[model samples]
Target chain A: MTMNRETLINSILGLALVAVPLIALGMDEPFIITLATKVAIFAMAGVGLNLVLGYGGLVSFGHAAFFGIGGYAAGILASHALNYEPIMTWPFEVEGTTQMIVIWIVALVASALIALAIGAITLRTSGVYFIMITLAFAQMIYYFAISWPAYGGEDGLSIYVRNGFPGLNTLDPISFFALCAVMLGLAMAFSAVLIRSRFGLALQGARQNSQRMTAVGIAPFRIRLVAFVISAMITALAGALYADLNRFVSPTMMSWHMSGEIMVFVILGGVGRLFGPLAGAGLYIILEHLLGSSFEYWQLPLGVLLLIVVLFARGGLVGVLAGERKHA
Target chain B: MFTLFLEQLLNGLQSGVMLFLMASGLTLVFGVMGLINLAHGSLYMVGAFACAAVAAWTGSFWLGLVASLMAAAIAGALVEILIIRRLYNRDHLDQVLATFALILIFSEGTRWIFGSFPLFLSVPEFLTGTVMMPGEFQYPLFRLAIIIAGFVVAVGLFLLIGKTRLGIRIRAGEADRGMIAALGVDIDRLYTIVFALGAALAGLAGAFVGTTQSVQVGMGEPVLILAFVVIVIGGIGSIKGALIGSLLVGFTDTMGRFLLPHAFATFLDPASATAIGSALASMLIYIVMALVLFLRPSGLFGTEA
Candidate 1:
């Protein structure tokens, strides 16, 4: 309960994330506001990944599956709503809605179900096999998305208008940014609470020593699977937000590169740190903006920077700023 | 119908052979060094680029092939010494990220050097035309040559691993790193060699396939993923597994794409059937992988986890 350097840093980061966007809005710089929204959405996805990867010790390399699922869910629903068509008419009737809340719910449920199936199979293997399997599964989905032309296939689907939110102009950059930032805050708070709960303790325990946990009568598999599902839901939520932010959805969301970038956010911010994803996402977006505008081959420098972080700066930005975690 | 099936079968075998060329190196590295090199794909790209550049400059595909092997092997050795050596003891996540960074570097570096436009590598004149098969069916001679070349390399790898002192050291290194080090074997040199060997194989595959497809940046990724699928299906770290797994995947994928739409057209409307069939066909290998994992998590020939 004592105030700590990391907590202070986290507080500053959260506030700055919102304050900058607000300042951008006041200055009529909507692009900066949009960029900040991207940071928030990417950070939220990173947070989702951190739960299983950092806390549960399950390194999933295919989280983009859930992310794309969320994106496509939003895109499909919005497209159907715009076209005045039913999403499903078999067994019963299902209508598409432009409601943000409905899209979010659908995204979460769909991601959870898919994650459960994926995790049930992938979680059976550990180490390299797990990583490869997760990656392959995501690629499978990516290929499916590219070939399945109903929702635009390789071209992608774009929503003509941003989906509705009650009493708010969802089309306004500032309004959308605020919504994304708020959702990010909620996700961080939820993760913070979940990590400190008894279930969180058990999850960490399993991660540290599954054999020891088994000896103490705890089943690691179920706990990890639950964490994995929860992680997918959070990321899926971010994906939906991201799709709305761009007003478009595509298979690029589910590419292995996206998964790697998500992992980079967690690593760049310092894995397991509460605000690591925010810090990482902020730095990454800023670097992308700055380097991208100035250099033709910006990704070259980005890659070098990433290599430096992995080789020398193991703790990432948070680790550099606040020092290493006491327990770890 | 039979001729079409025969042609598809040959296509599957050819692609399967190329998959083996990639997978063997990947599985070897994972087995021997306990490392997964995502940049293995970059090395493939390196080979393709190297071959294309050399072939274009010299006007000879043969010399370009040689350049590809040397270029890729050199790149592999440098990367092993500079980056991969440090990663041997780190957890998988660190390795994954570092290699992912390497991908970015390699991809961008290639683009910087070659520009964004794809370079083409043509098959040598000797291997250019189609040949008569049983039932008077014609197949691309280049593809048939790829299958033959792949088998030749597979045999070469088997003999190298089974007969040579270096192979003994590699197998030993896989079994116990500590033991090999204690025995005064130059472990660093050995690792560098294995990594380069794997890289060379990947490069060779890239060079070969480069002729059939456009030689371009980012080409190695899909093959890399397919190789991963092959290794996973055949069981990680098993060469025999990589071969069998590669063929299984190759056959399954090629046949699925070829046959699925027609099969589905039996019931569904042609347009819808083609759409559904191709989508499912693309996903078939992963489904096979899932089923394999569901039944045998360690893979067919993998050591029990």
Candidate 2:
């Protein structure tokens, strides 16, 4: 395949993301590997959001709900498994599993279902209402997480051991980073394919002009709803990985700030750019690490940077690197 | 039992009034500017911090209140001119991001100045005591003051919007920004004024509530979310909707916490009942919001989009 400028840049970014961890492993810098893993996981969540926000034009301010649900899914199941407790004991008994595959499946299904319900209601409203309703629903879940004591509530739940992968020593930071990086790669590939598909065109068309799309005999609502659910599932998967990386899950993961940060990853990278989230997340984590060590008030600089980006830099890092997207 | 209910009801009204203050400004900003200011809460924090600082230095609550209003309005106007003015034509996504960035800046800046500790503002000496109710029950005089203040603002807002010349310009601007500008209304100045007005109301709320709650860096956020719920339920651009929605949310939230656990205790064990009750109560307002939106997507009083 011929490599265009954007594609070449994306390839370099993808390679560098993996190369950083490998180099860190060679140098035995485990903390660097872990930070890279966080970037990968966060980038994956941003990828999920980019599908909806970038492509579909649905500004869901509640993607954290899926991410948190994913984290909790891992946390809850692992806790129950360690304690030898059944998650449910009634009509049909279900026990928790410390298996990573099981955890991912649970996270995906739960997030998809919740997204469907939330999308069904929130999709009815467009523009500002859509943004606010999505936020309100996420807040609902955040409060529920805080108040519900079943799985530790506001204190959060922790996994004593990393959930097992079939063949990997998940305890090692490099192995975990590889696992997360691989997942992020797969999510990006999937997003690229999805956006290139016929369904993707429909979704984009709806975003640009829903009325016109409707005239062309497509229901924008269903397309948006589907995109919303798919977007959530991917983010939820990231949340599961994040939980394993930290060995913890807390309501903080579901907070509005988390949602804002995830959105920032997309915006800082360049909305609609396939690799935007990864670029944005990588930049953000690096800034946090560098500035956090030096300045006590790192967020002040971060906020100023973001404001400048919004005011002046219409496109994000990828936009600066790759130039404006050529409309086909 | 009756007294307890009445007390909770009054508590609900007090909080509802606080929410109304926040929501009125938010709705007005959205209505007039068509901009969603996520950093409006930051202005509230500015107000609280301003009030706390002034009151602590001068030992005068009334003076602090005035300081809060001025501080928040000035901050709001500055933000509008410097940043928000540019975002008027951008998509909501851009506005949300810019404002979200503002939140980060405002919060971290305040933290740098105030340190990480919370500040306290004492209610003035005369308003510190409790007032007697009809059933010989007593309520905090400060809380009663908040409710009264909220109503006064509400009435004042109605008259200002309904009876005044500035209100006419604002309403006209909301209805047709281009048309008003074409007719020589100085739309930019009008937007700045509307934004400052909203910020002042939010500041007033922060100052009043600061006396009851600790003035802290992050206090505005939770209140901001609650205020968002109020405006969402009431309708985005409607002050009347905000007032009604604020009362509903406040009453439902306070009463749900007060009543649900007892209602559950009748059937379940005390511990579990309290746990489940509080959990549900916390989520009760969001559920109400969803229901309201289901029935009326624009909100209770919002114009159909």
Candidate 3:
């Protein structure tokens, strides 16, 4: 694996430009700011998924569960704060924190806990069973969200104001965008570091050959489960940010379609690439914006495009431009 | 309480049969072709559309049913030839992505042709009423007919898979793909037949369901999940498992919804009971599946793979 210095330098330069939108505050371009924010939020989610699907060799079709859980955490917390309701009462009166940092922490913990339970069970099986079980669990959460009417249920809940940040007005577009961009960068950096770490190496190795990993004295199950939980936590945090950005959260976030779209981003960006999520999220949103504006049947064209990509192109967009699938 | 329980049980049986119709084809295809087809739901949607369209045009429910089966089978075979056949040696992810692409194409194509509005079909006049049971409870006769039809198909499938020359070929294909092909069997044609057969079953389920509810785009997805649950619970490649698994899931899901709320109401407030019960009821099937996998990872009827 020879590293190309020029290409690496160019990638860094390109990524630096991604931050240029944060500086466009004087222009008052809400549209560009919002779009960039959306791209960042989605890319963060994609990075989370790539860890499990690409690095851990586990394709969880139930990621929407974690994503939705994150959103619900933020939404439910905000609603509780707004209404002066105790979130859950016992020895402690749980109340929503208006701070973005605190909300993200709750989201991360909630998602990680659920993932831990789900992964513990799902990791016991392999192949199709694993896929179906994850899907079933996701559907369970989706149905529960729909039926539970306390916090708006199927109608979804809306946050009146964006969650706060210490020194910045979060309602301001630039501040919010910066928050999301920082989180996205952090998630991406986390992924890169994990892939280079010993656990990351073991996870990748398990994906390549579980039998050989076991023969080499590593338990593939434990390694994959840890990676899956971390992956879910990252996605969950992104979900919280996404809901804050929209000021709304609903069961739709938990829907299987959301799960599918998350996987699509990872595949579209070139599965294992560190920047692939950012690339894929950018392309997806751009296509959605463009094709949505141009024609009514945008999904049809997008579907056709995806088919061609799967059939003819082995690697995703990154593969097309950067060559073969990059090794972790 | 007893009457409501009976009604729910009957509902479960009806849903189970519909699931079996869809799952049988999927299990057979997987057993023989070693392909994981995500486009099976598309075929189901196609069938429902064909049934609804033809029923509306000709004003004949029977004709509509036949058209649905034929259209779905033909569509399935065409898909097998054009796309699925090429995917025989591909990895599961590739298969998933390709079929996922097909889903988008098929769903968008259907919406383009039919528009986004849902199409409705009426249950035939003969099966529209309710049948009185021995316990003085009445249930929808149409649902009962579905159960009967499912059993008939199950028996027919059993005879076909276990007692016929085609069955032998299918089993041979499953057991030894290379050896069977070496013996000059047209494996490609067999795969096409299996794929078509699965599509036809999905069509039948869709047609039946369309009569009860409006046929619409994305209608096949929920049923697709149930079908997946059936195959997973039954064992991926086992027809018998699909049948049993569907029944267990259907019964458990229905009964959980029916009974759990009542049980929770005994202790908790009615409002909380409803929310908590519904949430727990929804998780019941998955919990059962997790338990099953824990006890027998290969599923009840699945062979050690």
Candidate 4:
């Protein structure tokens, strides 16, 4: 809200995240562009999850369901388009489209619907029940995707070619990276706007004391459900973009591991903070790339690092570096 | 057809019993301590690995089982003291995140020690035979033993929780942590003991399961997810809920897999039926859970969410 030291740092961090990819493109380092794309994608997912996790105080462990749903939506659409078949051949025929904008919409709508259904049920319970139920739902979807042979099943599906954007050569890594950065920027701005809105205030209030919010005529349950759905939509959108970036989609993208990683990004960045996801995702990718090159068992050290953060650094990397900034 | 159904039913019961063993520990820990240990699965993995290693070394299934119990107990105690105690007061998200980190650490550390390849534990020679059930069905002796072991553990837990002084303290602690602490109960030691007890049960479950399935890294995760479903369907902190929920889920999952193809074959071609059936079958338990929670939000026997 205010341009304080932390705010300045957050802006710089966000800029650096974008500028680094641009520099890599100028230097013709495709690998760095790919990595930056990954950082932006993961951060976007984290930003989405943070809506409910940090702001709404509703920990939906099943966010992977939405992410995976997003991936499958894109994968399925592209596969059907490649095959020249209608995705749905019931009362009406619906052909798949390889258009990025269309894919984003489909992914967003599909994930939002799934999220709505899951949120409606899971939102009834709070605390640990919410967490586990969300997980169970995600696992259910994962297994379903695995068992259903109609669209690649456990083997996963791939687009014959990278889906196209309006005017950009989507195959070029830099162009793709720019597309992801733009999405992240837009998502970040959307989140910032949502945070400043009345609904966001109510959600935060509900997080702190739902009973008090209720006493003040605010329905915490409704606030939480809306926030949950919106979070899932954002994550699902990220999932679609991620699938595009990789040119493949699989059930692994929807697995609990993805959900956990998404949470880790948000936590590692700084929960409830706008730039936190960006910072966290950036740090995680850099650490992963560095450590993965050196050791086969990088997760052990990463786990230890995460443990230290949870124990000692309660605020995370962004929180530690930027002392309690109000907003992005 | 009747024999086939009966065999599938027995299989369901066997796996249900295994689920019971796993879910019991989770429910007990939740009920007694209010801590959600995602690393509970890692402890199961530890038990399996310990049993596998010990059995390979000593060539004694009994000794291996004992080692699994001890390894899991010690690991549980250390986890309790080193990390879980601090998380008791934190929010559920922090606990989830912390335990999740423990999972990564434990999983990788185990992988470092055991290597990534799966280890197999053989059933002891004595229990390798099949036993005849009523109406001429043959069931694996080892699986039947798992069911019996599950029954034994269930009864033991019932007695321990229903009659023991420790159980009273646990109940008191659950009812009010501050009151129990004020009453001069050694809360720390009690927590460690309870956590260890839960971990031992999980270890035993793992050891029993390892003979049938390979002792692989990440093996506990799928089972852990199912156990979580069991507890959620049963209620977060209710053993009775866990037991009933496990049986219901086990039967539903097992039967759905066995019968869904046949059921779908009536309406669709066999190939697609098999695919659709299995797809729907895999989702049946979660559907049941959602329905159960919808009807009874606190679970059938759970006192609270």
The Cα local distance difference test for each model comes to 0.94, 0.94, 0.86, 0.90
What is the CA-based DockQ of model 4? 0.83
lDDT tens per residue, model 3, B1-305? 78878899988998888889888888888888878777888889999999999999999999999999999999999999988887888766667777887888899899999999999998889999999987889988998898898889889989999999888999999999999999998988988988998999999899998888899999998888888888888999999999999999889989999999999999999999988998889878888888888888778899874
lDDT of 2 at B196: 93
Kindly list the per-residue Cα lDDT of model 3 for residues A1-328, writing each as its tens digit. 2246325632863465365574555577688788888888988899999999888768788999999999998898888888888887888878876787888888989898899999998888887677777888899899889888788879999999888889999898877888888889889888989999999999999999999999999999999989999999999999999999999999999998788888888888778777777777877888888988998878888887877777887668776776764454
True contacts kept of 2: 0.82
**Predicted structure 1, TM vs. truth:** 0.99
The residue-by-residue lDDT of candidate 4 on A1-328, one tens digit each, is 3437668878798889888988988898899999999999999999999999989888888888888888888899998999999988999999998998999999989888888898899999877888999999999999999999988889899977889999999999988988999999999999999988999999998988889999999988888889998999999999999899889999999899888999999999888888889989999999999989999999999998888888888877878887755542
The digit string of per-residue lDDT tens for model 2 on A7-39 reads: 998988899899999999899999999999999
Q: Is the docking of candidate 1 incorrect, acceptable, medium or high quality?
A: high
Interface RMSD of 4: 0.8
Q: Which stretches of candidate 2 lie over 4 Å from their true place?
A: A1-3
Each candidate's DockQ = 0.86, 0.88, 0.66, 0.83
The segments of candidate 1 whose C-alpha lies over 4 angstroms from its true place after superposition are A1-3
Please report the TM-score between candidate 3 and the true structure.
0.96
Worst 10 residues of 1 chain A by lDDT: A1-10
Using all chains and alpha carbons, the TM-scores for the candidates as numbered come to: 0.99, 0.99, 0.96, 0.98
List of chain B TM-scores, one per candidate: 0.99, 0.99, 0.98, 0.98
Candidate 1 lDDT score at position B300: 93
